[model samples]
Target chain A: MEYAYYPGCSLEYSGKPYDKSIREVFKALGVKLRDIKDWNCCGATMYVSIDKIVACSVAARNLALAQNMGCDICAPCNSCYTILRKVNRYLAYDPEMRGKILEVLKAANLTYDTPVDVRHPLDILVNDVGLDTIKEAAPYRFDGLKVAPYYGCQLVRPEHHFDDVDDPMTMDNLLTALGADVVPFASKVRCCGGSLMTTCEEVALDLNNSILKDAEDNGAEIMVTACALCQMNLEGYQKKINKRYSQKHNMPIVFFSQLIGLALGVNPKRLGLQSMLVKPKNLKLIPKGMKVEA
Target chain B: MPSIPPIPEPKRQREADLREAFLKEVAGIPAGEKIKNCIQCGTCTATCPVSRWMDITPRETVALFRAGMLEEILESRTIWICASCYSCTVRCPMGIQVTDLLYALKRLATDKKIYPSRFPAHALSDTFISSLYRFGRIYELELGLRYFLKTHPLKLLANIGFGLLMIIKGRMAILPKRIKKANEVKAIINRAKELEGV
Candidate 1:
């Protein structure tokens, strides 16, 4: 499968592991990812919170760019995927806004009249790439490596287009197919407070505390998520989470793609596993070293 | 002199206007909401993970909007406190897009500029939008620096250690990449603002 990739801002920065792993995994799966040229941020939750028209326009520009690619736009970041998908839906559903979005796009010499298929990598990996094909490429079995699949809030909520909103099992099933022990994970769909970590520290930390505690108590050796922000919020803020809660949480939060990359025999360094804030302690069972074209 | 209760704001017209205004304020509201079908059941409140922190619970946010309590809704921290989790949006039996409604409310509050200066999250949106236009992409380092400087200088100092660790670990991209079409992005944004005429 070929896709127009939108890595968004988080993936280029704090969520670098997601970018690296996603690319490596997709490459190993025989999928081609084309970068959307001069793509802007998807306006995110912040822009929408500020101005609906501006945010919609900002998101629309990328959809416009991807339209020429003649393929679905696949984003690893949940916010990017959600914003792109939501804005596209908004443009299609409301004629008035759609007209305005068209005019706004014209200002940049762009146009988008069709619905954009903004896909999450997990959705693409499972449905588009198919689990059977993914399993066939795997050289390493997880040996029931206790894993927690954290879906965060955006990828499957508001619109359960690809998975169940309340109890999503796509990630759970995908990891299981790789021979990892998927935990019950009560907080799988829970919020990690997202950007709220920067603004409302206590609230975000409290939320992360529950997520970390839930996974740890449930016997998860590591937590894998599809959202860049979720990974960064949970893993990036571990020190603060530990300090605030007075709990020693040395959990290795990883991108779901990295786990797949490991199973596919991609080198840990290529998966950006070495950069994890809390080093991965449970990946010993999986063999590494795939000759990647990076 | 009889103390007239300020005639209560023409109750019905203002309520209609808020709903009608919402149709234009944000996308996702065009299909219309069964907001009138809301039984004040507080289902949205129960589903909201951040309800406890909100000054105006999700249930009241709807009720107040219907009641034309724009002042109360605007002043309350409920709109900003929302994490946009959409748990409430999914659970609302009335099919009210509660999260999108909050986004509309945030747009309204931002336009009126009534939110307190110390409100931390408010700084996030405009700065983020501005950065989106400026570089055609986000510069997280600058965004974080500006956010903390505006909201809490102490947090900025606290984050230095964390920032250093991230850079060392190769997770933090210290530099922001400016897109080649930044001018076009700015032009489009400016044109959008003019067209929006907010």
Candidate 2:
């Protein structure tokens, strides 16, 4: 499978592990990901609230750039995916808005025929790569692992397309294919409080703590998320809370791709395991040179 | 020696800071101009989730801004209660970006030490900032435990069982991870902080 991957701003700056693991896992699976050429931030989290027209125009510029590249757009970040998908859906469904958007895009010397498909990485892997293909590539089975697959807020919310937004099974199915156990939890659809962490920390943290508490309470060994911000809010913030409270939670977080990389018997170093904040001691079922520090 | 009570904010001075800081913080909002053109429409207030929780309405928030009554508005706990749902943004007839302005107010309040409490929100913000600073990214395990330790230290024992289980399962690694280009990340964060005047 080939895709024009859009990691967005967060992935480029703070989501390096997600970026590395995603590329590594995809490569191991014989999939090719070409990042969108000269892309800019998709004004979803704040711009949309600050200015609607400018936000839509920012998103439109990226979409037009992807469409020009002549391939489907695959966004790994949930906010990026939501903005692109929302804008594309609007352009397709609303002709008047489409005309207005085109007028705005004219300044950038671009026009939208809606050239490329906008998909999340999960949709590409499950829908295009197929489970059977993934199963064949698994060198190690996750027979004993119980993973809590968290989709966060953006992947399936606001509109239904690809899978059930309320409760997604794609990640669960993908993990099961790798031979890992899936811990069913209700916090999957819960919001990570969005960019409230930037503007309002209390609400965002409480919401994050609640979700983490629920995931831990539900017996999830770890939380696997596709959204980079969700991963950051859930994983990166845990240690500060731990140190202040004089506690520790060894619940390591991994991108879906990194786990797949482990299942496929790839080198742990190549999968960017060292980039994780909550480091897990026991990495996988494989007896490879995968380092585990307790 | 007598223990000092929490310092009370001077009403007039707080009001002035609230007005000036709010305007400075929300300066980037495109809808800021339209906010002054508001015709007393209740559309934004009707759509706000925090409306029922606080005395200040969304329209009233903008009204306060127009009247230079920002200090009283800031003193209220209502700023912390907004969810930033964008529902008000979508409904405003005057196209005022109430949600974005709310964020500006929060940034100002937090930076100026105007917060009401540290039990939940302030502590969470500290963690959020630390996570980004520690690892150029998010780590779920760290975030959860940190919240427990800071907000409810007594609950620390609860996560020990899971922590041990994770270790036994070979899923948890104890060593902290760092970016290969740590200084580059530090620079980025510094730049953002400088932009926010922090």
Candidate 3:
């Protein structure tokens, strides 16, 4: 399978591990990520709230760029995925908005036909790669470790359109197929308190603590999420919470793709597992019979 | 940590009344077309994680919207509890978008200065300020450290530990800098101010 890629600004910088691992894992599974030439930021989280026209124009710039290349686009960041999807759906139905966005794009020498499909990397793997291939590729089954599949805000929220905004179990099913036990948690759609971490540290810490607490309460040793922002928010903040509060809990938050890569026999170091703040302690947690070569 | 004072009742009203301004601010959005069509079906409430801890439901907030009780919806602590799940929009029978409404409400709430969100969401503006003030782009390490410094100073030390670990792993850059067009980014922020008139 092939897709036009919109890495957004974050993926190129601090989120390089996410970009690196996603490419390696997908390539190992025989998928291609064709970078969308001349792409810009999705306005991060501010454009949506601050300005509709600018947000749509910025997101459409990437989509128009991808459509020009004749490929469906994939956004690894949850915010980017939401922005692209929102603009794609918004411009598709609203002619006036579409016209305005197109006019804005024309000034930048780009035209969007809304030809490209805006899909998350998770959707591509679960829907395109299929569970059978994933199961066949798994060198070790994640049998005993209980995991909570976190959908976070961007992917499921605005539940106006997209997959089930709540009780989303697609990732759970895929993970289950890879042989790990999945936990049924109600806070899957909860916010990881993203950029709020900066302006409001106290509140963001509480938000991060709440997510980790819920995961710990649910008996999950690891939390799996799709958005790099969510992963960073949860894992990075967990260390601070643990230290400040003198908390003993340390749940390793991982990208779903990294877990899938592990099951497929990819080395953890190669997948950037060592770089995570909340490192997985005690490999003995994995059931004895379900050991991957990694 | 310094204790934050509670919002005085009269001061709270000034803060609560800002939702009207937010609604007016977003009046031109084509996306806001369904604001009036919201049916209180409780799908958003059913899906909202914050509903468990807060006093009102997401569905009730929609009901307040349909009733033209904009102030009540904005003033509700439930508004602060919103995780921006968008579940309300996804499940709305009338297709009223609820998540963006919450975001706009947050802007209004913050403006009113009555919003008592003492935790994480409050840090967003600070993160943006640090990013804009230094590197044109956000520095996750600084943002992360600054965030932890609020309630958990010890966590800041832990972040340094993690940063050291990341550096040793060759994952993070020792020096954080802006990419090309750093000035253009500030222009975008300036443009937002011009448009919002804040």
TM-score (0 to 1) of chain B, per candidate? 0.86, 0.74, 0.73
The C-alpha stretches of model 1 lying farther than 4 A from their native spots are: A286-294, B1-4, B7-28
Candidate 3 local lDDT, residue A23: 81
Better of 2 and 3 by lDDT: 3
Model 2: residues with Cα > 4 Å off, grouped in runs = A243-248, A287-294, B1-198
Q: Model 3 off-target regions past 4 Å?
A: A159-162, A243-246, A282-294, B1-31, B37-47, B50-83, B91-94, B105-198
The window of 10 residues in a row where model 3 chain B has the poorest summed lDDT is: B183-192
Q: Candidate 2: deviation at residue A51, Å?
A: 1.5
For candidate 3, the per-residue lDDT at A216 reads: 83
- List model 1 lDDT by residue over A80-155, tens digit each: 8888888877887888888988998899999996676999899999999999999888988686589999999999
* Model 1 Cα lDDT, one tens digit per residue, B109-128: 77767584457678888778
lDDT string, candidate 2, B1-198, tens digits: 999985355766776766675665454444455666778888877865446655577778777777766765666666766655455665677777676677667666655666654424445556644654556343435755786687776656755775555445433445444544434344434443333334
The TM-score obtained by model 2 is: 0.63
Full candidate order by DockQ, most accurate first: 1, 3, 2
Which window of ten consecutive residues has the lowest lDDT sum in model 3 chain A? A282-291
Question: For residues A142-200, could you state the per-residue lDDT of candidate 3 as single tens digits?
Answer: 77678999988788665334467667777888888877778878778777767655544
